[model samples]
Target chain A: MARALAISAIVAVFLAAPFAAPSYYVGLLTKMLIYALFAMSLDLMIGYAGLASLGHAAFFGLGGYTMALLLMRAHASAWIAFPAGLVAATLGGAVFALLALRARGSYFLMITLALAQVVWGIAFGWRTLTGGDDGLPGIKRPVFLISFADQTPFYYLVATLVGLSALAMWAVTRSPYGLALRGIRDSETRMRAMGFNVWRHQFAAMAISAFFAGLAGCLFVYNNRFVSPDALHVVTSAEGLIMVIAGGAGTLFGPALGAGVIIFLEDFISSHTQRWLLVLGVIYVATTLFAPRGIVGLWTDFSTRKRKP
Target chain B: MAISTTLRRTLRAGLAAMVCAGLPLAGAGAQTKTPIKIGFIVPTTGGFAPSGEECVTGAKMYLESIHYEVAGRKIELIVEDSQGKPDVGLTKAQKLVERDGAQMIMGIVSSAVALAINDYARDKKVPFIITCDAGANELTMPGPLANPYLVRTSQNGRTPSAAAADFMVKKGWKNIAVLASDYAGGFDTIGGFADALCRLGGKVTQEQYPPLNTTDFGPYATNLDRKADAVAMFLPGGGGLRFIKQFVELGLKDKLPVMDIYAQSVYEPFLPQLGDSAIGIYSTLHYASPIKSPMNDAFVKAYFARVKHQPSDNAPDGWVGAKAFGDAAAAVGGNVENAPKFIEALKAVKFDSPKGPIALDKYGQVIQSMYVRQTEKAGDGYVNSVVATYPNIDQFWPLTFEQYESYKYRYAELKGSLTDCAKVLEKK
Candidate 1:
């Protein structure tokens, strides 16, 4: 009851953020929520499923491009187009996973990287469809969601969507299927001997992970009102990986908090000094050296130490 | 009673948001007495950082000369880096508009960034003056994306190409070879030039788009048409340097007259490295240092004295934008609150820019002279000396609005392919 009350209070604050905070902060927070959702989805694969796919951005980019083509090209409405985008991203994930699951460990990482490059190549080389290097600009949200024109209403919509996605992820990770995936991560051979369909679970996790990532991508396109090949680049995938690692992989809500840290750090540091890249590097190095388990790990460690004393 | 309480709470939340927003809303509500703030967005930390640095320096030099005051209102310039990405550029633009309270936006070096924010700027009713970025034509051309609030002071992809084609026609060069980087800008530029050349009864014997950043133009050089009078090309960044060096090493510079629209690449910062290899090369641009005019002389003198290095074409682009802003501010009597009136003043704004007599078309694009220059030996190094001039050239040169509209509609479905040459040649 106490936990539920606390969660409701947090939701209330987020709900009122758009109306109570400055407009730019609302914009910044909207970006933070989308990135946090992306990071959490990545954590599902790398942390729980023990699958470190470097080309995760392929799904993200796929979602964005699908949304763009449907709305801009086909002139489809949001309700139909948004779901179609998710379906496209899920199929893309399954297809890439088929090629990726052909190998394991380091080979799996390389295959994922190669597959991502293939997607990037298609996005870059296919000029007629993706607009090549010129990129597709001027994406608009549905007229029903005209609050996107104003910062406040858009922030509320983003917060609600992100909250639901996060809740879904939390529920999935706490389920029995999630436990079996964790068991596979610990010892796949043992889990298989115990009659667990390890490959099926991993594949299912991959599809689910991609669905959430793609949803985040849809929100991203709407937020920025543009789409480009940069969405599909390896740098984007790497950013997700970094967020997962820095946020404390395998911990629910940790990656989300981690996303907030990195985004706010970049925004604040860049505003004060142009050499924000160097500052980010320093913080990353410090995090790796001291907080190996991440910010959540540090908090749990502190709480346990206090209890022991 | 519960609904009324909920409404009151909602009103309070909205009030809080507004109060928080109002804290940083300083420069936004500028009256005649308040200082007008202009937000400058450019790539200061990316591949285009050097170009951004040069543009900022030029703008600063101009601002310092004028003492940064126009019409009794102190002009505050807030600089933000777009990082050459559309997403980053839009975010920075939002920050500038919402937080910095800038009335006008200036200095976009990337076309994607400029186009990405076009709708938002129009919606917000902010007057955006594009300082430097070329390639995309849909920005000013009549289209769904084009907005009246956006004005481009920089060259479009086809402006220089049209001027260059006219220069070639005047020179009586019947056959020309074309080369460009394999990208959108390259295709757009070469296509414009080729079409214009064909329309003028000239022949383009060969055309090639090498993969971007191709270091070895050896195979391409060997395939050059020996019968062609000149080679018209568009190569970007260090690719131009490598191509020119390789062309010189292959002993092709002595044989064929090479020309391009972006003459700044072979001039100034790159000229000394290129040495005499760049000599006699012809190119057309909106501005060149050798142009003989009072405003040009003063700008060049001031820029050279301050920076100690000769200004590239980009310096004049920044200077021209700054001049327009100052003139518009003066016309409005330092009051930027009336956005429609300020936009009208900007449309009527014209001055003797360093690039020569400059004015705006109905579409708010810079209409100015285009200079065809040859790299000739100056006091020490080489300078692009004016060989020919096309005066009062608008964005769509040689084609009237009706003609251009008809042509654009006709070719709207046509991809700018190498096949365009054969089609135009057959028609000729």
Candidate 2:
């Protein structure tokens, strides 16, 4: 009951935030929510499935590029471009899983990383399509979504999309299929022996995770109304992995919290001083030292330790 | 009850800690009246940070001249880092306008960011100026008139390129190779030179668009046509520095005379490090820090005293932007309430800038002189020396406004290839 109440209260705060907060904060929160969605999708692969993929941003960037092309070149509406971006990303994930899942452990990680670099090269070299390093600009929102002119409306739209995506991910993780994923994570051989198609389950999870990451990317491009090579760069992939670890990978809402903390800290700290990178490094070191399992783990440990027998 | 109490205490402590962490270090000093807030955005943390820093220094120098006050009204400048990303640029721009209450906006180090927020600046009805970076001609052309509040005081990408082409053709150099960074601005620079040279009946022996920031230029350099009389190139920022060093190391500089489009390689700060290799290299740009002029001499001296080094191309952009803004403010009697009046004042004003004579054209773009400069030993180090001057140059050079309007693309670089100019022109 407490968990449910906390969840609803958090959502309520985000929903009410646009009306109460300043426009800049509203815009900042909208960006945070999109990043939260990306981080949570990464958590699905790393936490539950025990698959540490470094190329997750490949799907994220592909989603953004796909959406930008559709909107700018094909002149497609938001409804069409948004779903098409998801499908393109899901397919991209499937292809990546086919190549990456063949390997195990460090090999899988390296292969995914290499594959993402290849995508980065394409995005960078293909000037006619991606606008090269300068990036594609002047993306217009759909006529219906033109209400995005106001910060409040745009915030609400992003909140709704992020909320639905998060709820769906949570539901999937708690389902019986989710249990099978946990079993595979613990012992893949045992799961295979128990009549579970472990590979299929892993592949499905990758697809779902990629789909959400791609959705997040679509949201990001539309929100910024521009797309650049930075979206697909290795730094973005590394940042996603950092958010997952910092938020406590196994927990559902932890990654979202981590994303919020990282984004807010970057903005706030960078504003105060030019040496923000050094300060950020110090904060990360402290977090790692104090909360080995992340902030969520720290909270859970504290709560359990205080409970009476 | 004890557990709930502990949780509450922990949460309260966290909340207090966060509030304290988020507080501003020092509050703004009391002002007699609300100062005219100008939000200055620059790429202060990424690849362009050095240039951005120099621009900020130049702007501060301008402020120092007037004691940081304009017509009895204090001027407050808020600086934000764009990180050279369009999204970050837009977000910071919006924050400055929406949250910080900035009446005027200036500075952009990335063309992509400039294009992204052009409409936003228009829609918000804010007086915005592009100072340093962004050479896309569309920014101040037909598109800007729609906004009426937007103007560019920086040199366009094709400024030096066209000047180089005209100079080389006049000197009767027939065969030249074109190389530039592979991007929109790169295309603009190389394409402008190529088209102009070809139109003058000169031959473009080779054309190459090397990827920007490529650490290894071995492949691109070796493949260039070595027999060409010279290579007219545009590689900006750190990439230009690397490319020039590599080209000299490969002995290409000795084989073929090099003419650059005022790249970062030949900029004032890089000249000492570039050493003898950069000497005798012909280049063209709007401003050379060593130009012979009373105003430029004072500006350079002031900049050297403050920065402990020579000013680069970025300083001129900043100095001009601030001067233009100050002149306009003085014209309006420090009252920025009437934005149109302020913009008109800006357009009508003509005066000598640190760069040279500066005045706004009909399209709100700076019409200034483009100098053909050669790198020569000045005192202890090399500096760009003025060789030829194209006076009163506008963004469209040699073409009338109607000719530019009828052109297929806004800029010459959009035509794709040097040979395709006639095709494009015929189609138009």
Candidate 3:
């Protein structure tokens, strides 16, 4: 009963958010939700699989620009383009996993970082195809037989997709697959000793993460109606990593809460100072020093500790 | 995915769609007649933070005169920083429309962000008056103007770069080499330079497109061994400034004359960064110190008084976009709730900007004058001194049906010869 009410309440809040919030805030929340999906996708690799991939935005933006380029050049329908984007992301992620995931820990991170930069350069240097730094502009929204060119419909479309993606992620986390994933996370050697195909499960989690990120990317391009090389930049992937870690790693709702906090902090600081980055650095540092478990982690720890008594 | 697994995913997707088919439309919600806010998205980080500050300052300056009201109703200015990144830009743009209650957006320094929001402005039915980042001639022609709510106050780099090439072509320079960053801005710079040189019967030895953050121009400098009459370049952002300094330090300036298309932040961002090394380089600009207009004098004075620095090309677009918008809002009796009415009013706008005689093109880009300015030391500081005025230099692409055919046939590098391109001219 509590779980159903919790899920229903989340859906209700999402559906009613735009009406109550200002347009900018609504847009902000939509982006938060979108990035939350991105962070969660990254967490599947970083948190569960223990493979730190900094090349996540390469998949995210490749999915975005791929969807963007196809939506315009191929005149693809959403049904066609969304899956095509996912497939493209999956292919790219598989190659990345093959190359970078073969390594462990810091070496994996470094390889992914280098690979992410290679893709970033391609986005910026391939002028004829990618529009270089100016980026691909004037991409149309998914018609979906209903003109999502309008704001409200587009927002709802994105919200619904985010909700479903979160639900799917939760479902995945509860299945037998989830138990195996946890086994890999807790101890990969233990899983391997138990005669499990540890590499395949890791690969499967990565593929799943890439698919959801690609879906989010598809929504992202539609949301902005444009894509640029900056999407492929390492900073963007880092942002998703920050969101997952800052909100509390290894939690279902952590990335979403982290995205929300970061976005609002950025918006609020930019309102007052031209030097908002300094403010962001300070905030992140303070959070790290004071609340080492992260905001949601702190709450969960406090609540669970109380419950234990 | 494996073939059968992919099939199953596809099949499940179809089933999920079927399950959600009865969802009610989310667009039926009505809008209120409250104050209309315009989201101003610009960079508040990177090397371009000053430009964003100027944009906000200019908008606020104009908004102050109107008492925060447009069309007899209240108006609000919502600000967001793109941080010069697309993903961040998209997020900020979303926040602008959905969180700030903005019906309009203005001020994007990076073309990337502007392009990203171009679709958003259309998707959300919001007006975005771009005050920075000159576009490619292609965008405003029969192309990207697909977004009706989009308008820009800056000319494409093609105009100024072409003019600089024209100046070089007229100089009868025999050989040329081009160096530009490997980006959209670089592509435009290269295109404009090559087009102009080819028109003047000059041949380019080779063109180099370097990475954005390249500090070492030594190899690029050494690559063009063959001597040319002049070297034309397009470098902007933090990269552009570094290139010019390095190019001069390598003694390339002494061998070949350098001309650039860096109007907005180049003057303020780069020139100041280089105290003396900035001398003798030529650039094309929409705003120069010697424009010789009463409106410009007032703006120049007011800017120096406020910011304690001479204004760059950035100041004019913000000032002009803000002033034109303010006038349009007043014309609508300060009521910005009726955005369509404000856009319509701005359509027929003929405001005397600090740059003088600013108006909108068919695509909502400003059809304004441009000038090729030379960098000269004036009282121990570098200033962009106007060398020649190409009053209303037609954007490399044409606006009217007649000019369109002419531009495609006569001028464009990929399409027509320089003579042929010149013949298709909209205005001289």
Listed for every candidate in order, the interface RMSD values in angstroms are 10.1, 4.9, 11.8
lDDT of 2 by residue, B133-212 (tens): 77776677675224688878887776677789899988878798777877667776776677567667786777777777
lDDT of 1 at B279: 86
Shift of residue A161 alpha carbon in model 1, Å: 1.3
Candidate 2 residue-wise lDDT, A59-148, digit = tens: 999899898989878988888887888988999899999999988778888998999889888887776677776677777654564556
TM-score of each predicted structure versus truth? 0.92, 0.92, 0.85
lDDT (Cα, 0-100) at B129 in candidate 3 = 83
Q: Write one digit per residue (lDDT tens) for candidate 3, span B169-225.
A: 776764767677666666655665665665556766666777777777667877754
- On DockQ, who's better, 2 or 3? 2
Off by over 4 Å in 1: A1-6, A143-149, B1-22, B26-30, B264-267, B305-308, B408-428
By TM-score, the candidates rank as 2, 1, 3
Give the docking tier of candidate 3.
acceptable
Which residue runs of candidate 2 sit more than 4 Å off their true CA positions? Answer: A143-146, B1-32, B143-147, B408-416, B419-426
Instruction: Report clashes for each candidate as comma-separated counts.
Output: 1, 0, 24
DockQ, all models? 0.31, 0.43, 0.33
Native contacts recovered, each model: 0.35, 0.41, 0.76
Which digits, one per residue and each the tens of the lDDT, describe model 1 over residues A143-177? 56464556677777778889999999989999999
